[model samples]
Target: MAPRNDTAEPVAAPAGAAGLAAAAASHVTVTLAPLTEQLATYLAPADVQRVREAYKFSDAAHLGQFRTSGEPYITHPIAVTEICAGWKLDTDALMAALLHDVMEDQGVPKQELAERFGGEVAELVDGLSKLDRLDFATKTQQQAESFRKMLLAMARDVRVILIKLADRLHNMRTLDAVAPEKRRRVARETLDIYSPIAHRLGLNVLYREFQDRCFEAMYPNRYRTLQKAVLSARGNRREVVGRITEAVRAALPAAGIDADVYGREKTLFGIYTKMVEQKKSFSEVLDIYGFRVVVHSQPECYLTLGTLHQLYRPVPGKFKDYIAIPKINGYQSLHTTLVGPYGTPVEFQVRTRDMHHVAESGVASHWLYKSSDVSLNDLQKRTHQWLQSLLDIQRQTGDSGEFLEHVKVDLFPDAVYVFTPRGQIISLPRGATPIDFAYFIHTDIGNQAVAAKVNNEFVPLRTELKSGDTVDIVTSPASRPNAQWLNFVRSGRARSEIRHYLRTVKYAESVAFGERLLRQELTVLGLELPESTDIAWNKLARATGANSREEILADIGLGKRLAAVVARRFSPGADVVATTAAAVDEFVAARSAPILIQGNEGQSVQLAPCCSPIPGDTLMAFIRLGQGLVVHTTDCPVARRMRAREPERWVNVGWDENPATHFNARVDVIARNERGVLGRIAAEVTAADSNITHVTMQDDAASSVTLHFTLQVDGREHLARVFRFLRRIPQVQRIVRIKG
Candidate 1:
């Protein structure tokens, strides 16, 4: 870790200077004794004892290790436990938090936790363990996977994420101890994951903290500049808030409302983002200040809002009443930005006592439940339900990479509050579609998604929902996902479902293709083929990386890989020599299964840049190792042009299908550059019912347009249609298929 310069420019800050300062600050600890005493004020004596014992066990298990800042390793867990204690979390969460990192860093077996604690503790700890890997590789693949695992657990029992956020917050706060090069990644993760979780959970306080910490660590210089700007602004704005507060305090007294009003400045990252987004200096950012007004009664909240509006000129389009339609994370506040003294804008948040509590705690309702009339047993049940969800999603999905994507995408910070026609508000991750809304409402609605009504207008399921948009799903028994559904769906559940359906569809399609190919071979053997059975072959096929039998055939069909190669593996002793591919190259396309005409496998076959292949061309396939096989044309100037050069890479390949389905074979047409000539040529193609994929006119500036149409239709005949049709057009020109 290094000391950040906090300058506007990118420069290296001395690491040791920063490390020492952080070491001093980490001394602030809310230990188990005070934490348990706090819990005892609300929980039973037995429960406090249990929590205390859990802490001691965790402390002993993690004895002797030190953190980046040289603090006792116990301090970190204690900090995490203290945060959870604030949440007044249940026994399992508390216990898990105490021992979360033991398994991964200390190599303490999960089985030990399972036996000592219960399966619940072990599971929670395991979910926490999954988060540790995020600190590894900087690759998106690794980060995405790590994010996925954390989210899956979060979705299961939001606590996993809550505990993880606490861990992350402490990390970010002491990020100076980590390498400077590593700071950005940690900051990025914090912003992408932890901050979003705080926002999602309605933990505005934690959200702001996590975001600021990440922003600071990632851009220490920028952070310092921004910090200085904010501090300077605060110093200047003190009188402004005091005046506003005095006015509000006087107004509330006259209105006979009992309220607690607090002035809160915008967090650093929030201010920094606004400045950057608006491209203004910190001083140029006006209206970056806000106040929270906590009232006892809901009625008093409206009264306070009115009094505030009367006190200052209300800024149009800057008011939001979350009380009417609470945020997805159950945040309820009446927000307004008003033009105050000197026409400067000031923002105010109005909320009831309950909302205030939820706002500070975020999703940690333990604090609320402890004081509420609700029974502890009821709280226990909710915790259980939430924690079990992680297990469900984990059981359903095992791919670490995909799991991370789902969490980041599905469990996001921002949210859209939409409604059903009946006006039931539903909160969803931002950028979510009606399809996600449908699934959120009910699985069957998702399975049968047919059409949707957004604000009573029929709309596509893929439409992104907006706050206050009323969404109504139109589903039918006949409605089911096509492969295209995966294209626009935003929900993890929907995506997973679509992928599963597509995989099944492809497998079925592949099975039929494989059997057809097998029959074609057996038929060539002069024996009637028997029906193929058992799905075990598809698994083998997939493991071998072959998709459909055609793909397998295409490999053999193009003579890239010998059919005997696959046949021998799938079924023994299938004829090695008589395959048509052999004739195409060594057979047709290639002789070697893993062949290298030269050591040029990784280089692009780049169609020699001389000839471009259009849709309908006499194409050939070339086998190359690592780069897989490449498709080329028999007469591509690029291919022929290259054959004259590197003759080794010039392997033979013919169309897998005799009348090739579609290919982009280029044709160099020397024509007098004339207007109707291209039209006439295009007319010939239109008449042929084949489409040209591309047209590249040569830059010779000659009167003739060297047209390249990557057209679609049966191979050579398709090209002949363009040639023959053009021949009759009187602007008749000679045409030749270009290959590479």
Candidate 2:
């Protein structure tokens, strides 16, 4: 399990005024009064009383536990509850916040909490608890599983993550008492996982706080130094800031704009990140001055932008209109950089009051303020879609570690927006390819994607998309995801779906291949293949500890178990089958035919790269343990060496008479070192109807060069034609097919 905060405790009955005074006098700190007062602002009296009861129950459950800071354990839950109250969350969320750790730390049952506080509160608390009872090979695996659990729960109820983030925030604020090494670890995790999540959800307030707190915990010295520098810079920049603020304030009202304008500085962590990423000194980072203009309506946001531009020349190409196309997290603002006093760059963000609230609180705004605004509804819908994608990714991914990896990949904040063929806006992470876009539309589209058109022009599926590009995916039912797609796909959904398809396909292929190999071996043993309903098959499965017959075959197909050894399990008299080598050889010669190879055998059969074996080549296969069959040319040096070492692994394999797909063949050309010589060779190869997949050239002498090319061909006949064509070039001296 992940490291838990030592700060949770159960609740007892709420301390009334006199009870609070008595507890305070006894030095038992009680924080229920302030929490109740905060809740009273938004919640009804009955709801507030319920929250108080939950706090009391939690306090009692946590009786004598203490945090690393030596505070009563109940203080942590109250602090978390206070954060939730500030968001004006519902009474049940507050109750869950107060009792989130009881089930994990106090050993309190979820059933008991449900009976007392209702199922919603109990479920919320359950989501917050880690899976501590399960044993894992490593802390990372355990933490991943626990995170998977919590995130799935959060997907079902957004309130769960809200409360969880509050819990983490409070814990981070009190991290000083933790041991130094552990502090650093927790800080790193918060920065990598929790902070991005907070940002992805549009909780900029929590996100910034998480970053700065983590920065402080992980690098106290750098944080302190940077803090001092910021403070010093603040004094020096005050006059310029005042001038810009006064100029903006004075200009806005004259333009009939009702707005609240204020100057603000960037966060310490934000500044530090800029300096590190851009490789600049503090003084070189000139755009630290930030201003916000809050207006009454969305139209005024643009009007305010024009007013700001009129007051100060807007920096060219530094303006972004996020209002028209809100960010994926539902953040909407018009951002512009302008030349302030003395040409110093000053950044300004203009948004309406509602946008500002949503910008600051993110998804929390959906609950914090009850409104019928379309933007808020859109925000909620977008958040739900993202959460639903998480569940989709988890279902396709088998391991918790892999699921966490996909989620992290999906948490990226910087995105490029594109349009579908139907004009629907789709946002993906920056550097995302067409494959990611396809998957973003639907898994089926992604699985069968064959080609793509970006802005009416055909492009490779791996092309990185830019904002405003309209993309159309061309899919075919015959097309399937290639393993190569995993290299460039940016979306988590695409990666997981492709992997799931490949795994399923590979297992099926393995089972079929295993059956063929086992049948061949049984024929050589003078025994017939067993039927599915045969008793011998069941007995064999039991002896191999296999769950089913297919599993046993899959093992053999994957080379996990030798087919020769398994063939004896079906024979009534293994001694008779092995009685004479001469008899076995004669039986093998009469009945065992070589396995036929099709180019599209998927993962069950692989053609060796050492010697690109195409159809018409004499090929031998080696069954590598747990890796299936690897096909190699008969005379390949590597194959000869492997045969010498493990002759038993060698198998007879022959190419199918009519292979459907093209195969890769390597060719070497010795040509004159002329500028147009390489181009001529390429043209000749193309003229021969072969595609050059890869090429490399190196100078072999003063006037000659050696060129190596990998070409896609139907078979050796097509490859020979390519060689024959290349040999006609005036610069070409000698041509040879590379066999090894």
Candidate 3:
């Protein structure tokens, strides 16, 4: 059983205030002395001394500082430390928790902390400190960067995130004292980011608290109403809960299965979410109470489950054997829902005592190095694997906002269990594809994935995998990841790897294009392009603020720098400058023969979605800052508007005579609002050999309707073919292509 810390109680408040009073009552604030005593229960005496020293330093550093509750700010860190101590974290983690706010609030130097404490403790403190003072383009960007930095730190040492989560938890608990607007913002962020992270880490206790607190802060009246409703229901359902508990206890002991049987209620926030998501009233939300059976061993867990199922009729499709294939967070249990007495649905979880500890405490259950077990080691290895993947993602992803997006997508993994050819169970997120499965098995396999077989039948790599499907991935040494995989692959690791590979390939292509453009211009100058003698190009690189000549040329290819300016700088004299000027005009000349498009340039070339320009279209290119060349149709209204405002940024571009891939085109269809209008339009497109990617309807007009479609076509000719087919339809009033 987990020990309770009495000092970690919420602030006292007057009675009859309802939710606000309840929040204030549940808010925890701990003092230094009791926190130290709690640490002494698990930590060594020497470690306890270190924690005391950290408390004194943090307390002194935060002197004269108070929170919105008018309490000394030192109380916050102590409370955070107490939370960590409850997890049985190491002394370094406890010390770091105590001093987490000192550097941010008191401007203490990290080097000084390192010298006073150990380097690891100081590093953890530095990781917990926020980057609020730094400049950013926006607050969202700043937040993303802050999370990115913290996640990277957490990747290095998991203790950083554990402490950070505890800190956030305490803040959420005491959020009622803050201003209303800031309080709501904090609560929403806690729900969006931190709560999901807590869930991912398997910190169920903190996860539920964070969710319930955020729900209360975000919607106080609703929370209060729901709280009352739950209270009333608990009153009405008391006898049922009692009877069920009694039945389970009696059955377990009578069956000679020694177990700890208890009942647990779902979190109020969880109940509220179900009500909103399922469109159910509070009364309709059955199965509010669940029972847990803790046994001595794994076999006993199964036996207890069998006993419970025999006691009550098992609800079909409500049984899940997580013990056979544990959750990603190392949570193991047998979950089942049963139709109990009075026809109420009762949920039950059967696990061992050790499994229960991990289910509640998660990674923190194994934080003590001296008390390691196989279960704890498995938890540590799994956590370290995820953390190491974060480091890999950080290396592949440079943009903080994008990194956070990927991490967020990965956080809430509703997993599906699949099987390899050899029957090894592999768990992946729901809606994951064979590509994700391939990558989960190995990066090399993902990169080399040529084809896949599901249940001995060949399937597309984009096929969404279902549970219990046997998947086999075929690989070839010559194969590499296709950029299109980014559109369908669901796992963060696979997405990151595909993007990293594409970026690398793009850079290499840019270098080659830069070399060709520069060499052609030099040839026009009646001068030979110098080799990488380092002396000539190195001087030019220095003049251009680029690290090397290659980078300068790549910038020219990427349209970051002007080739004209580079040529002028590279010219030896005025005569060469005039010659370079002549070559610039030649380079600017619009021609279909010289400019080629193979449709394989990853990021360097992008077909504008506004016009959906395809092959054999009269195309022009506009270079946006930081984004490479954006190809647009010549007559596109959006392109015309942009060109009218910024004519200098436009350049000559043309499609290849034989382009390698199809393009997306937007088509508008106005037809009589009949039963089969959409079907006829789809059939017409299909007859014209086009694929409709997306469809949307404008309004519910009685006689006429307008439908918009994004379709794949070979070129402008193919689009015209589809349009002609649509115009021939009898019910079609009008059909036009959308350029913007």
Best by lDDT: 2
Poorest 10 consecutive residues by lDDT, candidate 1: 1-10
Superposed Cα deviation of residue 393, candidate 3 (Å)? 1.0
Q: What's model 3's overall lDDT?
A: 0.79
- Per-residue lDDT for 1-740 in model 3, tens only? 00111112223343465444345335545456787778778778899999899989997887645565656567888888888888888888989999997887688999999999989999999998878555788878878888998989999888888998998888887887777787788888888888877877878888889999999988999999999988898889999999988888899888889999888999889999999999999999998999888998899988888888899999999999988888888889999999988999999999998888888878877764336543677777778888888888889899988888778767874777899999988878778899999988998999889889999988889999998899999897756788888888777888988888878866776776666556655555555677888476776666556787778667756767545445544567522222222233343542223345555554666778788888877888886644457888899999999999977677777665668555788888888888888988899999999988678898648899889888989887888899989988899999888887
Q: Each prediction's TM-score against the native?
A: 0.66, 0.86, 0.75
lDDT of each candidate versus the true structure:
0.64, 0.84, 0.79
- RMSD of every prediction: 10.5, 5.1, 9.3
Q: What is the full ranking by TM-score, best candidate first?
A: 2, 3, 1
Instruction: Give the per-residue Cα lDDT of candidate 2 at 458.
Output: 83
Candidate with maximal TM-score: 2
Please provide, for model 1 over 1-740, each residue's C-alpha lDDT reduced to its tens digit, 9 standing for 90 to 100.
01111210112223556553345445745366777777776678887777777778877766544565655667777777777777778878888888877776667888988898888888888877744444545556665565656655665667787777777766777778767777787687668666776776667788888888888888889989877777877888888888999999889989988999898878888888888898988778887788889998889999999999898989889999888876656677999998988878999999988778776775676555566852234324433433343444455466666655655565565678888878877767778898888877776787788778897787767788889898888887645565567777776666765565545444444334334434544444444443234353454446557664445544442334443234434354433233333333333232332221221111222223344443344454454532334656566555566567655544543333332244445566667777777777777888977776567677446655666666655555667776677677665456766543
| Candidate 3 off by > 4 Å | 1-31, 368-374, 476-483, 517-528, 534-548, 555-740
Q: Across residues 372-470, which tens digit of lDDT does each residue of candidate 2 receive? A: 453588898889999999899888888999999899889998999999988999999888999999999888999899889999988889999999999
